[model samples]
Target: MRVLFASTRGSGHFHPLIPFIDACTARGDDVLVVAPPGLEASLAAREQPYRIGGEPPRDELTRVMKRVLELAPDEGVSLMTTEVFGRLGVAAMLPALEEVCRTWRPDLVLHEAYEFASVVAAERQGIAHARVAVSAARFSRSTDALLATVLEPYGPGITERLRTSPYLTRLPASLDPSPYAVTHRYHEPSRPGALPDRWGGSAEPLVYITLGTEAGAMPTATALYRAVLEAVSGLPVRILLTAGRGTDLRGLGPLPPHAHVEAWVPQADVLGSASLVVCHGGSGTVFGALAAGVPLVCVPLFADQPANARLVAGAGAGLAVTPTGGPADDSAVLGPDDVSRIRSAAELLLKDPSYRARAGRLADEMRATTPCRELIGTLDPHS
Candidate 1:
């Protein structure tokens, strides 16, 4: 069988599709990727053939994204879903992506939840397709209406195809149960790798901090970074902060000797040793922390991070402290009070054992999920 995997430019949307793609390739199936040029470096490393799916012009994208950040998180998600993915993305990439579907004629098309072009193109071409979720939130409430409008060009009942299609996800169902049924639960992709060189197997509690891949580029990130550093200041725990790829450490100014700063670190390597994780509540970090049985202190910025944070907090696995008011107001500045709250939350989690116990239980539940590789056979359109 031949499989065509598709995603937009963002890392959050792209990572969830990897395990399934790798599963298809490992079985000797022909595979190709459909993505934009910004992701070439990431795709090149996969060593598979890919056609560049052109994206919206940069000026238009920048104009819209600027407005998105200025709005509250919910509003940001709404506009982003309708304009960015629903209209701009489809208008920009559909022609090229649909052409690929018509030409490549792969056995199946798989796409992340937000990559609207692929599913629409697959629908237009009558190809088999599936939806791979990036987060446990499932995006049902958020995307249903937008998809209904965006999917109309292909034909009637396009939304039904998405509904009945094979759905794969890494949803830790017990922690954040979906309102709808989860067709299949898949484990997060992981590989053993060396920890950051600055880390020295410290016996003291290790607090891992990461803002995910794209958060640093947000206008609000600088203040959040400063606040996170300040929140952990004077704490007894040793800090290991991954600043995301291409981040310049010098921009962060001086750091404490006890805090280890690196542009990148093997998350799997550090999660096992971390006593607690502080993050932007991106699904990757939230899910990774839970799977490793490490509690999280989530400072959600936008998108689904606030919900992810709340679920982690509600489950007693960790705390959620949004310096920017999270979904309420994205443009709000991080104040000292917010920083203190983060500090207090971090301290409480470290001082208490209940959080870790709950996190460990969630980890056990996630580990019991079927691996993505095991689900490849289930994608066959013909029963």
Candidate 2:
């Protein structure tokens, strides 16, 4: 089979598909990756054949994203579907991606769950396709609204592609919001370098803190980072704080004596030894921490984050501390209560045994899931 995979520019979106791409190649099937121009080199480094699926012009994308971010939860999701995926996504990439499909004539098209463009193109060419989920079903609820907007061009089959397509998810059944998604065991992608020795295998409790790349870029997230720094200022634990590629460590306030700050670290490597994880509730970090049997202290910023935080709290595996105001508000400035909540959650996760036990259980569940490689057989056109 000739397989084509498409994803948005984010690493979070692209990483989930790597296992499948590798699986196809190892089986001697031809494979190619479709992504924006900036991701071309990264795909090349992974030794995957690639094609450029041109994205919306930067200025237009920025404007559309700004508008999408300002909306309330349901409204935000609807706007994201219509604006980002509809306008900036499919509308922008369709011509180029379609050209690739027409010329390459792939047997299967696999795309990031929210990147409906590839699915639409596959439908146009009558090719088999599936959605690969990088996170829980954060946007599934709004998909019907998205389908409504594109009903004329793509019709109701697009709705099936969005809502009920055969798909792969890293989240265990417990964390996955959609029952239709198949739980593919999580596999950390191979990184280029060795793990940093910042934690030092300390017997003291170890906490790993990161906001992921996108969350770290937010001004509001810096405030949360500072609060976390202050909360753990004099704690007995050894801390590994990653400021992310987009974050400047100097702007994150003074580092505590017990903390080590770095621009990046292999999260999977750090999580293996962490006693607790503090993060911005990115699905990657949430699942990473859980898979490592480390409890979490989630300070969600926006999008699916707040819900992810709540899910953690409800599952008894972690804690979620969120700003009282809406997503659009400047949540960077934390009041005393907010700081206390965050601090207390960290302290509790460090001290409590139940959180750790639940996390370990989730880890076992994740491990029990079918591996992505084994599941790739389902994508065969003959099957």
**C-alpha displacement of 177 in model 1, angstroms?**
2.7
Tens-digit lDDT track for model 2 on 144-222?
4566566347655576565666767777777655656543444433333445565556667888888887777776666
Task: Give stretches of model 1 more than 4 Å off.
Answer: 196-201, 324-332
Candidate 1: tens digits of C-alpha lDDT, residues 294-375? 9999988788898889889999999999764433545446677788898999999999999999999998888888888778
TM-score of each: 0.94, 0.90
- How much does candidate 1 score in TM-score? 0.94
lDDT at 235, model 1: 93
**What overall lDDT, based on C-alpha atoms, would model 1 receive against the true structure?**
0.81
